[model samples]
Target: MNGTLTLDGFCHRLAADPLRYRKLHPVAMAGEFVDHFGVPPFPRMEGIAGLLDRSGIGTVVLSHETGGLRGYHVGTRDGGYLIHVDASEGRVGQEHTALHEAYEVMRERLHDLHPRIGLAAGISLCRQADRFAAATLMQPYWFAIFAEASGLDVVALQASYGRSYASLTIRLAEVMRHQPLLAVLYERGPQAERPPGMPGQVSEGLRATVVARTPGFRLRMQRRPLSALRGLLPRRGAPPPPGSVAERVALTGRPAAVDRVSGYDLWRADDLAVLARPVIWGGQVAKVSVVAVPYRDRSVLLPQFANAAFERTFHAHQVL
Candidate 1:
């Protein structure tokens, strides 16, 4: 392969023969990094976090009285990293956001790897490798086992996994890419359809915009209750609802709106109130969005700082 992996080719390979490639490249990246830098093995998230700390990526708690959203990152003048994660997002019980941030950091470092490929290919590989790594590490089968052993539902999963609704939902979707049970759960969940006067169909542009604008954008997928899968693993917790607003928007095909002011109130209550709006495309709601609200006393707004930075940098090059 010699690291010539094209994005479209990698995606096609993943779709065509997912299992064979599932643990291949990301694991390769890990192996290469360890061989080059002599880093210790990371058997779990905490281990990876520790590795990041040693690699000069600093993890810090960011407190700004915002109530709705979870985690984000800031760059340091010294070219190091500072990750700001909300404690509220932590309440969702999974570590999706943290993992996402960590993946980003990893991608940044991948660019600095020796004998680098062309910029376009290198960046694409880095991001895809991060996704691949995350999917491999948090396989849905493992989640099923964990949920069974621990008795965690969506709410409990949030508690145990330390992930937010959006992150967890997206993670579940990623898991479905490999596991049949998760695939079934995702397929059987409620799906959204557009109203007659709405957009005709969904598009990638619409999806990106909605995701960019929404808070907790990850939560729009249907989640499976851990309690129902007891026989597949071992049983543990009470079940919660299976679907989220993103899933609902996709299923109902309706454009939804959220009042950020009211959302602020919920946020101030420390409830991590996430508000979502739908992006209409081709006569349908193409995507659902979520954003964390600041405290009740504060004004509701886009995560301007983070969003602006992401918009400026994300996809800066056609290859990335």
Candidate 2:
């Protein structure tokens, strides 16, 4: 649980204390499963490693016979389950399917034990299995330790982890959820229409999604055109739109600032700054991560405050 995480070390710990994880959360269970058996995240996994040992998985049948289905969990007459993973799918896809099917098989058992659980819960359980799959690959416990030592150097971490930019940033947001900050993702895509005649048309722009935040920090007016951000500012003095800088950063896909945000005024900062970086995916700027950067000097210039690696990483694949 300290320093660099390793598959062998994690397995040793889990084996040493099996009862400790007997009643684990879904996310934790996924992490432990991958940690215990070294399930494929990036590098290729040997023929169905983790799923083979699971009791719930009666048999892992690799087939394209499920009528184009990548993976399917089928229950037998003897009340056993068979997980069919795609024979044509890559290692990563297979890993996800296997984990998802495994969770689904277990969910079926839980429902049988409590008939009142309801069919509506099946959809929710499936969605939870998706979460479990994500957690299995990018375990938060390991990610937290890695991020801390690396100064939350996201660019390096993303490359190392071999995950999508959004996945890495969103996980970073989750890791910092209890701290004094607001982590948001702004993606450039087709804009959704506003309430009729509500605003000037700015078709095709960045749309913001709140990834995670500390309990104290809140931004109700988070949107494509952050015009309502004016209300979030202190009313004592006539203030400019706080959203301009962030909007520009999202639009331009760079680190920028309007002015130095006063300490403890916005984002609950003693020494912090708004740092935005382009979330590059497949050689294009698809999204941006706008988050608070912990810094000593409040007067540092816009892009200079941004990490060199972070800045350079996106600039290679500039704004779309």
Candidate 3:
């Protein structure tokens, strides 16, 4: 377990034998750790601290000068771990950092793998540990239940999970794997700089949009030729209609009615309609997630009418 392994190599090894690493998945592994200490679902600050304490993390300190570090773990004199959190990062950030550090500490104990002390290996290790932290904080099964009951509203998800937008979005993608749905994350950019083939650009305020779609949904999108009907990959310049859901949502941060957008949106199918929700962080629209159910029955992924609407909308707005 002690050697130089690139992050890519480590991931490839896990992918090669999924069964062996099955227990290594962040959610599954974190659940095991939580269960060991009888931690309940949606464990908050105290519960997380308890998990850290029981995982050989001896002390948790909040520091004013993290030196640009969000969190870090050091070996204690008695061979335990000390986790330091940057208090300036706020509560959510501190929680995420603590959990991530605790996970790495526990991982080293459970697997008997020596901690990578080298800077390069340490950086890779931290990245992998961060993924685990996200899964642990979000708790996939619990989040999936919430998503099913409440739908995929990014703001609501953040509130319920008590996690940062970035954490929830990353973990949400993992939970969406078993479901017949797609979850995407978009980074907002300026309206005028939208590249050709991007679908969700708006006027004046919102610019670059980054959409992260589920694997299955992305594949389905690839089979379609319509630029607007595909995933957020930039295409030859084509703007959605002025009053379309993409346009309205991009501009106003308000979701267009599902029925109104049923046949016209890329995320919607004949039977399964996608829901678009924006994640606003730091007083700006940082990301938008589009969740859609995958194909279940034999029907056109993109109907001719939807295609016609795209053409009409494109033509109508071309003069602008």
User: Residue-wise lDDT of candidate 1 within 11-49, one digit each (tens)?
Assistant: 233334435333235544334334433334323546545
What's the best-to-worst order under lDDT?
3, 2, 1
lDDT by residue (1-320, candidate 3, tens digit) is 22213222233343445473575666665665554455566666666776556434546888887788997778877777778888788677777788888767655654444333212237776776777777767776678877655555555677677776655666766776755444444454445655555544454344323234445554344466776554343222333334444455556565432322233335554234444455556875665554444334213223322211222221121111
What candidate 1 gets wrong by more than 4 Å, as runs, is 1-50, 65-70, 91-94, 115-141, 144-194, 197-320
> How displaced is residue 103 in candidate 3, in Å?
2.1
The model with the greater lDDT, 2 or 3, is 3
TM-score, per-candidate, Cα-based: 0.35, 0.62, 0.66
lDDT of 2 by residue, 1-320 (tens): 33213323333454456463462345765766666555654433344534443434446777888789878888789767778888898776777677777666654554455454333255687767766665766776677767665445455566677655555665776555544554555666665554343333222345654355556454332442555443343221221123434445545556553233433334433334455566655765566555554333323223334354223121111011
Once model 2 is optimally superposed onto the true structure by TM-score, how far is the C-alpha of residue 221 displaced, in angstroms? 13
Residue 81, candidate 1: Cα error in Å is: 1.8
Count clashes in each candidate, considering only residues at least 3 apart in sequence or on different chains: 38, 0, 10
lDDT of 3 at 68: 89
Query: Which structure among the candidates has the greatest TM-score?
Result: 3
